[model samples]
Target chain A: MTRMFYSLLLLSSLALAEPGTVIRKTDLRDKPFLDAAVVGNVSSNTQVDIQSRKGAWMQVKLPSGQAGWIKLLNVRTSSGTTSSSTALANVIKTGSSGKTVTTGVKGLSAEEIQNARPNLAEVAKMSSYAANSADAQKTAQANQLIAVQVPAFANSTPTTAPGSNIYQERRR
Target chain B: MKKQFLLPFALAAAITASLSAPAHALDLGKLLSGDTLSKGLSVLSNAGEALNTSVKGLTPEQEEALGHNVMANLLGAAPLMNDAKVQRYVNQVGLWVAMQSEQPNLNWRFGVIDTPNINSFAAAGGYILITRGLWDRIRSEAELAAILGHEITHVTQKHHVKALISSKSQQAGSDLISIVADYNSSKSGAKAGEKGGKALSEIFVRGLDKNDEYVADVNGMVLAARAGYNPYALVSVLQLLGSVNASDSTVALLFSTHPSPQERLDNIDQVVGEKLEGYADATENTKRFNQVKR
Candidate 1:
């Protein structure tokens, strides 16, 4: 029953073609691989329908109805505005009733922070939930998380060609 | 460079003269006199050497205390969510991800603040807080891990601490000393707490250096990958953030404090490019995420 529910969830997610724009010019590959054959080209700022994501590749359908995979980083998905009803749905979905609503009801504003007084009691409570290194390691092991060595700030060189995108001037 | 050296010397001389003079009777003429000036300068030179030794960097204990004080002030703005399971789950995930950071052994604490503002915060010495609104938008554990990883990078890099030191260093010579003193006295009362709180809030309002945010984005993705999660998770989250309308209140603070989502994405793309593509197949752990998230 749980498997079926997840399968349905996956299907529904795929069926919803999220609108996105190619933020940078990228090749549309036949498969989600760098070595994969380039089927087409999606230019910078071209609108596309993002069908689904697999790893770093997103399967997107171009305006001409051609579908192929592109690097997920090259595209920006349209923001699905979180209207009141969606917010209400999220609240209900979390299974926390209306009684707990008071806490997160208002948006946290700068003015609120500037005038706020420190809540030492809440700070103390948060401390109680702190996780130690050993427990964290145990959780990692349970989750089958294998530590990988990734260099911090690995690349300092800019790889993208100049004038490739709108942020070119801002690039260091 | 000459001004930098002379300012500290002059300030230190002034302090030494004030300490030696009788209470409520600072003799300015006597202070400027050759004898008193020489005496104060000699005493200040000794104290300056000691101050230099202590001012190298905040000790680990001091960083933690300052972080705790900042965390308390932030909690004052938005209290922690009253849900132990969610809190514990976030801590476990956050800590596990943080273990992959350079400062793995710091006393890491993670809390989900009960606020609708879609933002996350990282305090020095390993205090991370994510808002409930941000939590609600997270789709998978990998996404959660990525956000936590970004905040983790800030702590690991001592971003906040460095920012604090540099900002304080801009003031008179006594400012840095007073910050250290403030942290030392933070244990006592509400007055100290208020001061520390105001300083942190101002930093949050003014925001970190834009380059620091970009560095966090790049390093954060690397950290998530190190923890064996999909590195693209942060890209996905940024995509989500990018999709939100600029006028939306949920992301107002985040937008104000961070580089625009599109700019962040572009910055990450410039640095990361395809380096993390290899780790794309890493786990998202959506099932466990959903279970805990619900």
Candidate 2:
């Protein structure tokens, strides 16, 4: 059954049909650039099967089997999902000490985080990355980035009730 | 504390004595009848007020500690990118943007995590990390500054603190408030503290509320502009993300955790549309960015 499934997966990848919907009205061109002859216009919400990508354009085939490229940003993948949720379990491997140890994946899965012990060593390591206010100020001056106060917010009236510890400079 | 309430009541009694003495005699008699119940209720109300004050979000110190733990968990997933220059560059750019925020003195540290996933994180305190993949994709410092600006807003606004309480709304009550209140002293928590700690780490997995994300987007632009970087860099990056194939594995993690790039682009555009003088004159610094990135 596993062999059958692997073959089916390979077959599916060979004959792909990843449908996506257009996000906005953009030109469907013979080539990826705007200079190419406009084959047609793929209006917003129009569906197209994504084939491949050029620099910034997605090559898609129309339902009528005519293939062309569309601006990559114009479409949303129909079946594509962002599932970085904690589904993968903790990985266990044998260490040099000849004992098994549990380590997490490259990007933590949620379960691994829930079960993993607190890493104080890692916490201290990140702290070494700290840049103090003075050092930060130097970076600004070097870049010629002057601090300009944008008076969009009401400085006098804070958004939240100012706690005793909150440093509020009331120019009022 | 009782004396404070007595002063107000004494003044009120003095004022009412002149006009409503006869009327007050009847009211006073009624009050005396249930004086015990009223006094108990007043004490309870004051206790409620005290609890409300205590539940107010973390002090900067507590927030700082929370950010460290959260950042540690994130680093556990992806270690810090081993380039000191790159890390230093992120800190300088991020700190410049943060200095203009409300919490200027926050221990703002920026890191580039060594991961292929294209995602940036903002914790409760001023800890932020942009993955190496996202760093490589950005073409200019202004764009990077804009991204940091958005994440910094999350910190300044205490979105992570609020998110911890919110995600546990089902079992909310005093226990929820206790998690926020006791978050300051890491050792002060019971099982509630344990739950809150778990939730804080889970922030990397569970993104903030959509409204909070939008608020960060708009305000981040403002901060980025104030720091003298082109504010529209955020929008341009949003457009770039929108252009990337949604099914692409590099961006799949980002795609799940944030509002659709199209939605964020439209929402943030509304914020950028609000005219502020000289924002157009903001710097993009494409050349310096390319050099630093290299």
Candidate 3:
């Protein structure tokens, strides 16, 4: 009776991670960029807690209480609980045989897509509703979207490593 | 690259195959004539038709025709959400990006399918659709642009048409299927029509070539940047997708049909690499996005 059990640890654990472990030798960088100086390195299967994500980078805290970024592909998350139980948890089944069946869940399930019959009228409508280039250009101008020149990945900014996997996929 | 033999090679094969028909014998009802006329003719005819479908080049006009049927089937699967405001907003964003694509002159239209799943489709002839679920997850106009840019890349690259034509499983006659009347008259053609429908469905279920997908990701980033959006916004959307577990029904089809989100993110990092830090303050257009979304 002298001590009370508080669920603070459990709450905090759930808040910090999906309980991830590194799958390869990974550098912990000061920032998400690969060119950022490596503050430390963690070996394969090293346990770490995932904190946040940016593009391919994940901000993670290591077992040693040090935190930095890791490539998202380098770590695997341990499953805690199944998020949804039903075949499609969010789907709203309006009717089985109805042509226009939609539930609150919103979109078609994979099964429905596989079984769908062609609707020519709808297809025609989709075709007729197209936006011309002038309309598109005006919309962009309204949104203040100024086109920028972006190089193809082959001609991308030079990377720190010459033969990195990042640039290899283009040729692959 | 797919092993797309030249038309002359296919024609040669077809001619050679037709010539090899059992021309040596003719029998009258002792079972020789029955096999020679009926089954033999059917096999040769099926082979010729199959070869025709295989080698036929889909011109830009024919590509649009193929997309029409595919779009019909997609609409049957999931109808567009019935909100004109949302639809127009999405179309505005989509059209802006489409103008920057390879097929900028092709009529471009975008729609939001009323499903709560993470999915998008690019029909040939410049039609793109995204599920409301994925739409809801987008936090900024730039993120929305990023998503549209990826889907639009599929159109610009002609990924769907190439996949549709090169698909060995679907009979080539399906490419010409315009009206139900095309499927109604002949028995063999009817069977081929059914196969064609199933093929369209299967194409949606599986996906385009893996390399095509990778290319879309790379090209999509470039297109987004060109449209005056933060190219990295796609990564934000990808991160959100990656955070969701595969068991979640929201991503059920997406995970099954796509390369894992992690690989896509990694590829993005590779393509953009160290260039990300410089665009950290790129325009996100949060106010406009919030106003148009929902």
Clashing pairs counted in every model: 1, 2, 5
What RMSD does model 2 have?
A: 13.3
What proportion of true contacts does candidate 1 retain? 0.67
lDDT of 1 at B238: 93
DockQ of each: 0.39, 0.18, 0.26
Candidate 1 local lDDT, B87-123, one digit each (tens): 9999999998988887888888998988767899988
TM-score of chain B of each: 0.76, 0.72, 0.73
Is model 3 an incorrect, acceptable, medium or high docking prediction? acceptable
Each model's fraction of native contacts: 0.67, 0.33, 0.44
Predicted candidate 3 versus true structure: per-residue lDDT over B238-290, tens digit per residue: 75676666777677888877777777766665556556444444566745566
Higher-ranked by lDDT: 2 or 3: 3
lDDT of 2 by residue, B94-120 (tens): 888898988888888888876555778
User: How does model 3 score by TM-score?
Assistant: 0.67
Q: Which of the predicted structures, 2 or 3, would earn the higher TM-score when compared with the native?
A: 3
| Worst ten in a row by lDDT for model 1 chain A | A157-166
For candidate 1, give the lDDT: 0.70
Q: State which candidate has the highest TM-score.
A: 1
